[model samples]
Structures are given as structure tokens and as C-alpha cells.
Target chain A: MTDTLIVPTFDEPATEAAGRKLVIICSKGNLDMAYPGLILGAAALGEGIETHLFFTFWGLDMITTSRMENLKFTMLGNTAMHLTQAPKMPIPALMGSIPGMTGVATKMMRKQIADLEIPTVPEMLEQITQMGGHLWACRMSFDMMKLNEADLYEEVEAVISASDFMEISEGAQIIFI
Target chain B: MPTTMIAGRPIDVNDEGFLSSYDQWDEKLGAELAKLIGIDMTEAHWAPIRFLRSDYPARGETATLRRASTVGGFAIKDLFELFPGKPAKKMAYIAGLPKPKGCV
Candidate 1:
């Protein structure tokens, strides 16, 4: 019997008006952790993707106006923290526990980021929003933190429930951190 | 390193059709490239193109969206409307410059 082969071809380029959606769930408020979701969301927006960031728990600190600019950088419990000038040396985790260590770490980290001309967290949030990325605060965490709508960056859309987040993000690739 | 007839002249373009030779690009070619990508050219469109063309020699790299704003004075949101889906890549493509390397 003669057989016919059928092949399906998809000719669309991913960056060409494809309605790709990405939902990044941010649960960490640490200075370093904040960048991943924000940076990724920005990249996705630049690629014409619909990007949303849900800030919950400590992550709420990222969108909170009072704390966003002052997010802490602590090497506590992180054995990988080492000075760039001394990359071979390991920083003792206990060293992060020292009082004022986070301040030193934050200052150094900020300087490094500034050296690369990276924007501050607040500036990044503004940039992402201007690029059409959506930012949502977890309602429960928002209430638990005693945060009102006014406490959030003005660009934040709204505080939404987990179910609502899921509903809005259906068919989107979700990343939790 | 492939050559194709575009804008009524032989032009150098990469495999994805981004112009590879900077000197071969002019206003006419930029508009032609933009049309192929479904972009209707406007004066707003030409600003970033000119910026990228002039900025490339000094920087030696395509400007990211952020650089387009901070350095070139074109706001990010406005650039989005100008180039639509992918501003950095689209602007670079229409300008006959290399694609931007920075994420933002």
C-alpha cells in the first residue's frame, strides 16, 4: 500500500507578535533575589511577551514603596558570598550574622550594580511598568503586611488573590522563586 | 554574508534579513526594511534609526531599549509604540544595525 506522509510546519517566529505569556511569582524580598523576576519580566516584555509579576510574602517588599528602595542584601546562610576581589576565598556564613554586615554588603552590591549602570530596583520597576509589564501584590500578604494600595508603587495594578492570579495566568509559563 | 536586491539595489543582509553592511543602508532602505517587517514608517521611527546609525560607530554595539531611552532621549514606552512587539530588535533591524545584546 502506498503511504502519504503528512507534516505540519509552524512558520511563526517567537518574537513576531506571538502572544507569549509569562508569570513570575516572587517570594523573596532580598535585594539580589528581587532582580531575577524584574529582569526576566523586563526581558519578556522586550520580546513582546505579556509579563506579570506576583509579589507575595516577603516578595511584597519588592513593590512596597517604603521598602523597595531599601531592600537588604544579606550573605547570611549563603556560603557562596565572597568578595569579587577575592573570588577564591569563601565568606563564612556566620560573618553575615554580624551587625551592620548587610549594610556593607548592600552598599558594595549597589556599587557593583551601578558600575554596570544597572538601574535601582525602583527605577527597574518603573521601567518594566513603562514597558507594559503587569505587577500584582498578593492580597493576603498585602493585608498581612498591613499594606494598603497606597503603600505599593503607583504602577502596581492591584492586589489580587491566588485564584485570580491563576485565572489571569492560565496558559502562561509560571516561574516561582 | 548573503547579498539580496533590496531598495532597488544589491544589499547585504544576514540570514534573518537584518542588514549586515552599515554603509549599504540609507533612508530608502530603512523604510523598505521596515515595510517588510510590517512597520509603517513615521518620523518617530526615523529618530531611533538615525540614533542607532550614528551611535554604532562610537559604541560599537547596538543600543538596548534602556540605552535608547537614557542615552538617546527616546522613552521606552514611546519606543514600544514606534516599533511595537520587539522594540530593540525591530529598531536595530530597521536601522541596519546588529541586534541589541542587553535584555532591557
Candidate 2:
């Protein structure tokens, strides 16, 4: 039998620490809930940290321009105080016969928010992209909602699957806003 | 009450007694102070005082004038690095100065 002696290496382990990455999951449908993730992500990016905002479910409306104008901040709904007690009127669905009530509401809400010095969602998106933060739309959610790529805001980087998002999320600090 | 402004925002001197502790901040040197702080002389009159008051502990009571200029941008962190202790008092003292505002 040949005896093989195992020797341990004495050098200090040179471990490559992972770079800081933060993932923000935006799920709210209205303007008040939407700005936090965008602002924080952009600020983080400005600080030279990698940031990602993943839009899923109702949050997917954040990137879709066609649906963007229809985001409702209803008094009947549970939304931020700034948007509370606003109109929640329903629109008729007669094959485009009636103008979208939500769109009208969004415009009113946008005006109110602007008057209060709150930035709009599109403005937030512009800031986020300018600061090099990434925006990902959930592929399944987009398909389920029957949304087309043309309907989305210009800054959406990709339509990613949940698994792909998870792969990126594994080592990141994930926050659902 | 010690007070100054940066970027149009008002800042109170941190230590409660410091504003009256020192004589009125010289308004003639305000332009020079603004230049040192790297902010416009007009905009530096309010917020810098409030910010320095709120973040005074990061600056010691007697920080070198060179370190005072960094308070405008990296406001809190730079002050802490320069003063290490009693940053609030130091920042208040600097904010009270008739010297040029930012980095020379």
C-alpha cells in the first residue's frame, strides 16, 4: 500500500466577495405605492450600487404606457393618504366606446400629485434608467394580461421568467415594495 | 439660534445654545463662504445651517477649515471623518464663520 500524505495549503483564501445588489419588487397599482421603489433604486444606483426593480402582477402596469394612464387611485381602494378619497368611478367596456375612467382618474391624480411635488411614474422610470438601474417585466404576467411589447415604456430591459428573476435574486437583498 | 442655508433649505445650529453663544454670522462674508462650500452664495444661506445643526455630532468643535467645505455634498460622512467627535459643534462653528464656504 502506498501512503499518500495530504498537505494543506497555508495561503489565505482569496475570496471574491459578491458586489452589492438590491432587488425591489413593485406590486402596487397606484402612483403613491410606486414611487418608493423607483426612488430608492435610483438613489442606490447613484451611490454606485446595482439595483433592479421587478414589476409583477398589478405592478406590471408601471411599465406599460397603454395601462399607465389607467392606474387608479380610488377612495374605495386602500392607497396612500395622498391619493385617498379620489374618484373611483367605473368605465363602460363597450369595445372602446367609452373613454377609460381610470385614465381620467390617473390624469386628475397626476395633477394632484404634481401639485404636491411628487414625481410621476414616467418621471421615476426616466430617473431610474438614467441612473443605470434595471427594470424587468414579468413575462408570464405580461402574457397573462395580453400585453404587447409596444404597450410598454421604452426603458423596460427584458421580459424575464420568475426563475430567471430568482436566479438573480438568490444573492441579492430582495425587497417587495 | 444658529442658522444658515444651503441650496435654499434652512439649517439650524445643532447645539441649542450655540446660535447665541457666538455673535451674528457675518453676512458680508456670505459670498465667500458660499464659494468655499461649493454652493451658490445666495443658496447657501439657509439649508447649510439646518443640515449642520442636525448633523453636528459628525463634526467636532474645532475642525480645520479645509474639512469644513466637504459638508455641502458628502454632508454627514465627510464631517464625521474630519471631526470624529462633537461634529455638530464643529459644524456650527464653521457655519458661523465669515470665511469662504467650500473647498479652497
- Which candidate leads in DockQ? 1
Please provide, for model 2 over B8-104, each residue's C-alpha lDDT reduced to its tens digit, 9 standing for 90 to 100: 4344333332233234444443343334333343343444554544443454332222233334443443343343232333344445532222211
DockQ, per-model, please? 0.29, 0.03
TM-score of each: 0.91, 0.49
lDDT of 2 by residue, A4-29 (tens): 21111111121112367789999877
Model 2 misplacement above 4 A: A1-18, A79-109, B1-104
User: Worst 10-residue stretch by lDDT in candidate 1 chain A?
Assistant: A1-10
Cα distance off (Å), candidate 1, residue A16: 8.8
The global C-alpha lDDT for each of the candidates, from Candidate 1 onward, is 0.84, 0.56
Candidate 1 residues A97-172, lDDT tens each?
Answer: 8999999999999998888778899999999999999989899999898888989999999899989998989988
- In terms of lDDT, model 2 sits at 0.56
lDDT leader: 1
What's the lDDT for candidate 1? 0.84
Across B1-104, the per-residue lDDT of candidate 1 in tens digits comes to 66777756777666666777888888888888887777899888899889888999887889899888899999999999888778888889888887888766
Q: Pairs clashing in candidate 1?
A: none
